[model samples]
Target chain A: MPLIKEGVLAEDNWQSLADEDNLVDGPIVVSLERWQEERESLLARNTPLGLRLRSDQSPALVVDDLERFSVVALEFPKFADGRAYSYARLLRDRYGFKGEVRAVGHVFRDQFLLMQRCGFDAFEVADPAAVEAWEQAVSEISVTYQPGADARRPALALRRSRPAVA
Target chain B: MYRYDEFDHTLVSERVHQFRDQVERRLAGELTEDQFKPLRLMNGLYLQLHAYMLRVAVPYGTLSSTQMRKLAFVARRYDKGYGHFTTRQNIQFNWPKLEETPDILAELAEVEMHAIQTSGNCIRNTTSDQFAGAAADEIEDPRVYCEIIRQWSTLHPEFTFLPRKFKIAVTGADHDRAAVRVHDIGLQMCRNEAGEVGFEVIVGGGLGRTPVIGQTIREFLPKQHLLSYLEAILRVYNQLGRRDNLYKARIKILVRSEGIESFSRMVEEEWSHIKDSALQLPLDEIARIENYFAAPRYEHLDDNVREFEVKRFEDREFASWVRTNVTAHKQPGYAVATISLKPVGKPPGDASAWQMDAVADLAESYSFSEIRVTHEQNLVLAHVKKADLYALWLGLRDLELATPNAGLLSDMIACPGLDYCNLANARSIPVAQRISERFSDLERQHDIGALKIKISGCINACGHHHVGHIGLLGVDKKGEEFYQITLGGSADENTAIGKIVGPAFSYDDVVGAVEDIVDTYLEYRTDGEEFNDTYRRVGLAPFKEKLYAAH
Candidate 1:
């Protein structure tokens, strides 16, 4: 692992990202510019379980394909570009995206915590040093809201059970 | 007055521990800012313009003296000795460091308070009439229903991440003080032909870009079907609200796009399907929640308040305070005293720690320890006895909390605009300050009568500009602040969004513009018509004509 700035992504140090036993795994995302014949051939041979999507991907390609992949990665073009944040939330909350949702590419470390809070369980931080940071981030809190898909019990559940409202 | 049972306490306790864990992870470098943002937001923490702000919900604006004292303690201990009460009946502590929010939230939970749903797209704090259980004409105590809705909406799985934030206000009076007409969904309690209580549900009323007074979707929705009907509305909004455009995502937009008729139809259809599910109100549950809000044991006293009136006439300050601050309570011996959080020239709704402590003490002594925060940016001590009014008034005056401007022009509702909020296009507090200073004369303010001047830094309408009797909207004219004034708007029984009067004014000239309008109203008003009444009878034509005619 290499040293990563507080907010900078660790994507460039992809080779240094080490995986551990029973750890969450993220799919390798081919850059939009690299999606060519050679990439297609490589993908076909490898048969990866999912594809990391970019903002430029045509909607026709992503919508209504229920069985196409186990996960769909949404790239954060920039931290300020909240379009991807909404995209990720909508994909899970509205589009019924159930598999390993990952936030990858050009993401700020600060944003990673929020992204995970919004239901993105996996991240592909592009730096080696960010791995420890990312790991530390994931374990930061336990218990979450119920309205969203997070694990925190909804406050309503904590309500005192009553007989009825006459 | 929803008493915190052990279960409620445990839930908030666990929430604090969870947030603490989240903080640890951030320190450990596990949660990146991207991952941590929503988590923090869910806990009512926000990284605003200067520092992180934590907004704690004073659910339905109701609080006990003990709870208010806790708020004061947190403000002094963690914040910069003060907190800002918001229009949603919540309080925002400015200057809370990111690291300290979990502890602050823990403190809040200790007082049976939490920041849950203060942020996020879920149902925010349910607002009710500040006069809720105490109003003279209230058919039922509204806070009881508000608490029920709060519990039902908390962690509502299906509607948590709706297209945008949702607000609900309930009122039990014919003269709707809760501003029910300007909410996403406004529920007003009414009695049926058989004397059975029910709700009149209004949908789609909101005050963002496209302000619309809610349309009555159901003239009489049975009280027992409250949750199911609300569920139906939420379901329809969730399934259809536009997710593509952030600005056009609130249910208001959907209501506009689908048209009220079609939107109501969809909600009705949905209700038909799930109205009888677990969401339906069981008679016992309503009774159980109502028990928490039952009228406190009241000492049987003389209904005639003649002695209190004589005493007030004797004391000039007390007389003025009673005239401006006290509101009629249904109980003959009691009155609701509104402690103005807006003290003349100070920022609207900013209360110091010491002030809060004083108010808490006053509440304990004078009002059976019950306090409420109004959406109009005031603190209300409900259930104050007329016999003890002088003592409470004297104590409040000592703390500079007894400003005789409960619903007066000086009691402005202004947002944390550019000064604090990153979303603001211009500053709102200074504008409010200037107006408050301009109308600092008490006699003149009384002559002017009840007028609400709500200012929103941007079109988000957090300050509820759309519902103000006179609304000031701040806009950025190429990085410089400009304000557009509106008139004839109101948020009570005759709720309507204000109409834009004329041209926008620079910040310096904005106060003059308001004065000009007020003068025009005074000059033309027939008899003792209020700002809203005059504007309505003559229409915005007179004010608008007066405002821009000279220009």
Candidate 2:
């Protein structure tokens, strides 16, 4: 699967370590359980480390490990679940985690902008082939009213760009 | 009414195209009804029993003459020659074909309107006091903040997919015309010790199956911090509100279970981080929006209009109408006139194409080109010159819009009920019509004075039956429609969920039961107190005994 980093297609660097998979030399992403068990040795690894958080898990749990990990991948268990959106914001704004916040599963073109607004710098979508089209969703609305972690100007700044039609 | 800026125009215009594409894909069989249901609801299109019902948001019940004319055009073109104004201050067209909705929305967008977020699990349209700006007693205009909330809640990335639907109502005056207590998040504008305008924020009040009066979570939230505070409350609910049981998923239920103390703490903790963030409303921007809602210029005239006094003295019928329908306006020579949608035998809150066009013309000519739809299912001309009240009444009489009942027995709020709603278990419209017809005599209705008869077809309480002074909730038991009556409920400052009096009445006896309850009030009254006041003073024992005697 292809990953989106900073609005462009990128090869997925961090691989999730499954039950039977062995670790390689490159950076690795592991489940919350795996990270909890191997926190000492995983931090000791030369490669960059990351954690994959499930929908039920809070980003507050990773507060102490903010500097320990380079990425925090939040999982969307299903389409209706929005807990991950909050987690991404919490990680980016609350904990001051200046790391890659990736949206892992069940990502779609429709919610691409929503994910981006919630501070997901990286996206490992269900279908990577649709990345180019998903990139266009960010510009669907030229202006936004809410403040988010995404690098878009607030509506006030953009108000002058499009004058009122008197 | 607020004019749409270029940004707003572009936003709504682009949304029409998005909906058009979505509808085209659904028609092309690329998307199933299951996949398109939520998407369609986000745009306020509901699949009703007879056809597609399109609910268009009348934000805070304010509409310009242009928008009103456009609505009339839409009603004539797409619907069955009429539109139903709803309790949430929206208008629902009962017979728009699914294929024509995109075109309908496109037409609506031309007049700075759309059906966006009118229905769905998202933060629905922010409602406020219908007489927000013109009300004599208002501290500040609530629409300014309501518009702010509308912009922020539109396509809100995080709060869109909440556990259940959320509603927010605001009142700018001391009197609670907006029914702020029965909303998910109710903001009552107030002044602090230092004379700063702010909101007395309440959380978790709702009417459906588990009706609960909202509790105040914050005594005073500063005006500038409105968005940040709302964001905090929503964030807390999104994380903790129940998703397992749809029945118990509303913010009211969450507030009830979590307790107000704990909920307040959580919201405060969240607000601590985002208080002065980008969501903090800039003072200039707030003023910019406020400038749109400034009071219109008024002519210098005496408080007592000699013509109105003379007309009141000479014409008994006109005097009766004026006594009930006319309310004081802030300006000395002006009055706020309510045009009741409920007539003797018509469906409540419904307006025909002719009626809509006439209203637009009337508003343009007499009321600063602004009309308001009241939660009580009536239209208000907010700034009419008292001297012209007679002419306005004559004009309204021609359109059959002059139903002199603002808070009388026949002035009822009822849902479309089984006539259109797929979720309704009984017919509310026919029941309302029957009650209105039962007590159709104008003199008798006036003598009875100020009774709220709200009937909901089902437990969803779309009719606001829970807060009606004479509340009636229609139920279906073994396929027979039965009505449950509750006494002493109000949406005013003293907000309380009505208590079910006794066993339900059969549809045949429902009107008679209501009559019996009203008779009970008349018999026990010392003075001519309103039905709600009488009920509260005397208690439900007498009313209950009369209602359930034959049951």
Best by TM-score: 2
Clashes of 2: 0
Writing each residue's lDDT as its tens digit, candidate 1 over B1-551 gives 78876556665787687679878888789888877877687678898999889999989999999999999999999999999999889999989987788888888887899998899777889999888888778899888889888877764545555778899999998999788888889999998888899999988888887888888889888877888788778867765777678888878788888988999898898688667755566686688788888997777777677879888889887888899898877887888899998887899999999999989899888888888898888999888889889888889989999889888889899999999999999999999988999999988998998888999999888888888888999998988899988887888888887888877989888898899889988988989788887887888777777667755
The C-alpha stretches of model 2 lying farther than 4 A from their native spots are: A6-9, A17-26, A44-46, A127-129, A160-166
lDDT of 1: 0.77
The C-alpha TM-scores of every prediction are: 0.81, 0.96
Return the TM-score for candidate 1, rounded to 2 decimals: 0.81
Q: Evaluated with lDDT, which candidate comes out highest?
A: 2
Would you list the C-alpha lDDT of every candidate in the order shown?
Answer: 0.77, 0.88
What digit string (tens of lDDT, one per residue) describes model 1 on residues A15-123?
2122222212344434333433244553564544455566445222556653445656666664433345445545665566777666666654445555665567666
